[model samples]
Target: MPLSFKPVSGLRLRWSRLFQRAVIAAAISVAGTAALQAGDDQPNSLPPVLQSSKLRLEARLAAEQGDFLHAAVALEQAALVVGDRETAQKAGAGRQQLEAQGGAMADFQSLMTLIMEQTAPPAQWIMRGDETGTMTPYMQGVFVGAPALAGAMAMTFDNSRLSTAAELARTANSNSDVLETSALRLVSLPRLEAEIARLQKSGQPIPADAAALAGLTEVQFLFVFPDSGDVVIGGPAGAWAQDEKGRTVSTASGRPTLQLDDLVTLSRTFADNGRGFFMCTIDPKPQQVQAVQQYASRLQLSARNARQETQKLEELLGLQNVTVAGVPADSRVASVIVDADYQMKLIGIGRRDGAAGMKSYFELAGRDERRGAAMDALRWWMTVGYDAIRVAPDRRAFEFTGRSVRCQSENQLVKVDGSREATGKADSANAEFARLFTEHLPQLAEKDVVFADLQNIFDLALASAMINTMDLDRQAGWQPAVFTTAGGFETQPVEVPRELMTAAASRVYRDGSIVVQVAGGIKVDLREVISNPQSFTTAPEVSSQARNASPVGQTGRWWWDAAVR
Candidate 1:
C-alpha cells in the first residue's frame, strides 16, 4: 500500500500547485477588461460585434497558452461587462475552437458553469461584531464572498475531470421511491454498476437503493469473492431523503446517505495517479490579511469609531480562498469536507452553538482570568481518525473501529506579510477549545447534519481507500469496475463555492490591544494511519463474518439484509 501524509509547515497555505502556480504564471489579464467592454461605456468606440470578436481572439490566445480557465474567464468577464451581446453564441464557438485545439471539453465547460454562477463583490464587505464584538459569521449566508475572479480562481480544480455527464442516478428526483432498510446491508460494486448500466441502456429511472446506495452509512465489513469478481462493503443502511440543506440523510437515523457519486469519486481518486489522499483548505488571502493587519494597527479602537473601524476591517479582509488536492474542487465530496470545516469554525467562534460540553473560543477567552492572553491566531481543523483496521487471517475481512473525524488545534503568529507561522504552543484557553471540539463533536453532529455527513463521507473514503490500499481487488481477483473507466458512472456537478470571507472578529482585550484572527482549513491525510503497522490488527471474528457475508446465489440483487446474530 502506497500511503503518504505530508503535513506542511504549521501555517502554510496548501493550494494545489498545479492550478495555482499556472494561474499565477498566466497573470489573468484582468486589466484587459477595459478593451473587452469598449462598446459598453463608450458608444463611439468598438461596436458590440467587434467586442465579441476581440473576446474570441483573446479566448483563443488564452486557450493557445493551455489556460482554458482563463479563456472561459475572459468570455465570462465580457458577458458581465457587456451584457448579453452575442456572448452565448460566441462562447459556444469559443468552446468548439478550444476543444479542437486540445483543451478538455469537460474542463472548459465546468469552468464556464463556475464563472456564470459568480458575480463581483461589493467594494466594501460590510461586517459587524457580536454584542461582545466578536466577528462570528452567520452560519448560512453571512460569509458568502463574491469576488468574481478570485472566487473563480480558488474554486477551479486541477485538470482532474469529473466523470462525464452525471445523471445523479435518478434517486429522490423521481416519483417511485423504491428503497430498503436493514441493520447490516451488503452492497456489491460489480452488481451496482450492472444495475446502473442496465438502467442507462433501458432509459429507466434508478431507484433509491441504486442511487442513494441503499442508504449506507459506512463500510463496517469488506467482503470479496474472487470467483465471482465482486467487491462488496456492508454497513448499517436505511431509507433516506433530502434534508432542508439538500443533503441526503437516512430517514430513520438521520445519518448521511452514501451516494453512488461519492463511491465513484473516491474510487477514481485512489486510481488517479496513485494519489494517496484528498484535502481541501479554505483560508484568508495573505495579501488581504496583511492589509487588514496594517489597517488594524492604525485603528484607534475607541468606542466612537467602532462601527467605522469594523467596516474598514471587512473591506480590506475580503474573502478567503478554497483549494483542494486529490479531487476536483466541484466534486460533492470536496464540498462536504470544506463545509464541515466551516461549520466547525463557526461552532468554535461562538457563531453557532455546539453540544453541551463544547464551549466556543469566545466563551473560553472571555473568562476573567484569560483576559489578556497573547494569542493572535487560532487554527482549528479536522483530520483522519481511526483506531485500527483489524484484519482477518485471510485478509478477506477487516473491521475498523473509530470516529471518522478528529479535531486538532494550533496557535500561530500572524506574520507581517499576513501569513501565519506556528507559535509552537497554544495557550491553555486555545487548547481547551480544540479539546472540547473533538470531545463533543459526536454530540454536536447529532444536532448538525453537515458534521454527521462529513463523518460518513470519510468513512466511505476509508473503506474505498482500504480496498485500493490493501490490494484487496487483486486478492479478490476483481478488475476495476466502471468507476475509473471512460464513460462510466458520472456524478452530478454541484455549484462550487466562491471564496469564503475571512471569519475574523475582535474580542477587545483588557489591555486595550486587539489581536486579529483569520482563517481555518481542512487537512485530511490518511497515509500515516494506513501505512503505520499499528493501525492494522488481527481479528478472527471478521474472518467468520466474511465467510457468510457473500452475495453469492443472490444474483441480480445488489443489496441484502444480514442474517440476525
Candidate 2:
C-alpha cells in the first residue's frame, strides 16, 4: 500500500515554524563529497568548488528519496560557493527545479496524494494549523502561516519549501557591514527608547536593524543599569538574513532570530492583566467526536471495509477548532509555537522526517505492539524545558536557561460521549519517539531552522515573563518606547484561523487491525513556571552583572557583541 498520513493540526500560521528551512548565508562549509571541474583556466579542485559539487549530489539523492525540500536546499547551499560560477549556475538551476516540483513541503503533499489514491476516494489533506476542520469530501490544503514583519529584512530564498546565521569572525578590521556572531549580547530597552526618541527628534527614519531587534535570537540575561536610564538583555547572537518564509534568521546558523515584537507581546502576556501563559491547541468538537464514537463502537471488523469505514469516521469528526490564549493570534509569538506544534505532528505521523534518532509512529508501529494496539488515540505535545530561572539577590539580573523543546505523550481514551480521558500509558515505541524527539531536538533545529526559531521564541518568552514577573522594568525605570505602541513598530502579523482541521488517514493491516493516527497539541503556561519558588534560586551575580557588563560608556549604540569587551 502507498504511504498515507495527514499534516498536524494548527499550521495555517505555521509558515511561522517560519515556513521551511532552506539555504543559509554560506555554502555547507565543512561537508561535501567530491572535487569539481569548473573550467579549463580555473582550478577544478578548489575546496569550495568541490564542496558545491558534493552538496549538489546530496541534493539529487534527497530528491530521489522524495525529500525534495532538503534536497533542493543542498543545491541552494551549493549555489553559494564563491570560486566557481558553473557550480553556482547548475546548483541554482537544480534548486529552482526542485522547488518548482514542490520543494521541501512536497513530501507531505505527495503522501496525501497517494493516500487519496490508496486509502479512500476523497482522501485526507493538509490544513491550516489554526483552522477548525470538518470531515468533508474535500479538505483545504492550506499550511502557510501569514505573519509579515514590518520592515522585515528582505530575504537575501527571498520562502519556497516556501520558507524559511551567524557570527563573529571579523578580527582584521572594523568593517561595520560585516555580520558577527556573539556568544553573549545585551540590549537596553530604556536606552533603546532614548536612542529612538533622539532619532525621531532628529527627523530620521528607524533603520531596518532597529526594527528587527539587531538580529537577536535568544535572551539569557536581563540587567538594569543604575538610575533608570538603561536596561539590557543578553544572549547568543550572530549574523542574520531573512529566509523565504518572511522570518529573520541567523545567516550562518539558520536559527530564527528573536524579534522585538515577541518580547513586547510576551511582556503583555505576563503582565498583571495577562493570562500569564500562552497556548495554541487544535482539538475535535464534542458533537463530531461523539458521532465518531458511535460509529467506532458499532463498526464491523474487516480489511475489506477498513478504509471505507475510516472515511466515515473522518467525515463525522470534521475539522477542529484552533484556539490561542495568552498571546495575540497575529503576533510572532503565536506563529512560532503554532508552527513548532504543527511540525512535531508531521514528524510523528511520517509526513516529514526528523533527525537520525527520531522515528515516526509508522516506523515504530511493530516495535512496541502493546501500546500500539492497547491505546486508540494518542496525543503528543511540546512544552517549556527549563533547568532553572535564577535571579540575582537584588533581582536586577535574571538568567532564563532551558533546552529548546520537551515532548510528552499519553494514550487518550475517547468516551462514548466524545470526551477524552488521558490514559497516560504511552506505548514503549511512543515513549521512545517522544524521548528521541526531545533528545535530538537541537540537531534537528540545525537542519530545520524552525526548531531553532522555536527555541529562540521560548527563550524570549520566558525572559519576557521573567521581566514582567520580577518588575525588572520598574528597577531599570524603563518604559516602552521604540518597540512600543507610541513608537508605531509594526511586526509580522501572525496568521489567525477560526477553524483547524486534522490531517488523518488509516493503515489497514492484513490482520484486520486499523490504526488511525492524529496529531498532538501545545500548552505553555509561564505563570506556573515562574511562580515555582524552587525555580528561582538566588544568583550572587545579579548585583555585579550590571557593573561588570555595563554598557555605561556606550551611549549611541543599540546592541553589541559582548565578546568585543
- Highest-scoring model, TM-score: 1
Q: What is the TM-score of each candidate against the true structure?
A: 0.65, 0.63
> Candidate 2's residue-wise lDDT over 1-565, tens digit each?
1112233431110001112111000000001111121233332355875666655555543322223343434555666764445554544554455334322222244323322232212322112235321111111111111111101211112111101001111111232332566666666666666766777789897666665667676766666555635567766667788687767788867777777667667656554445444555555665665555455545563556655754665566567655555567777666666667767877876767899899876566662241233214555655566656555534455566566467765444444444333333566766777788988898899888768877877777666655554556666666665554435545557665646456644554444344555555543333334545655554443333333234434446667555342
Clashes of each: 1, 37
User: Which regions in candidate 2 have their CA more than 4 angstroms from the true location?
Assistant: 1-178, 196-205, 300-312, 365-376, 390-394, 423-425, 481-490, 508-512, 536-548, 563-565
Cα misplacement distance, residue 103 of candidate 2 (Å): 38
In model 2, how large is the Cα lDDT of residue 294? 51
TM-score of 1: 0.65
Name the TM-score of candidate 2.
Answer: 0.63
Whole-model lDDT values for every prediction? 0.51, 0.50
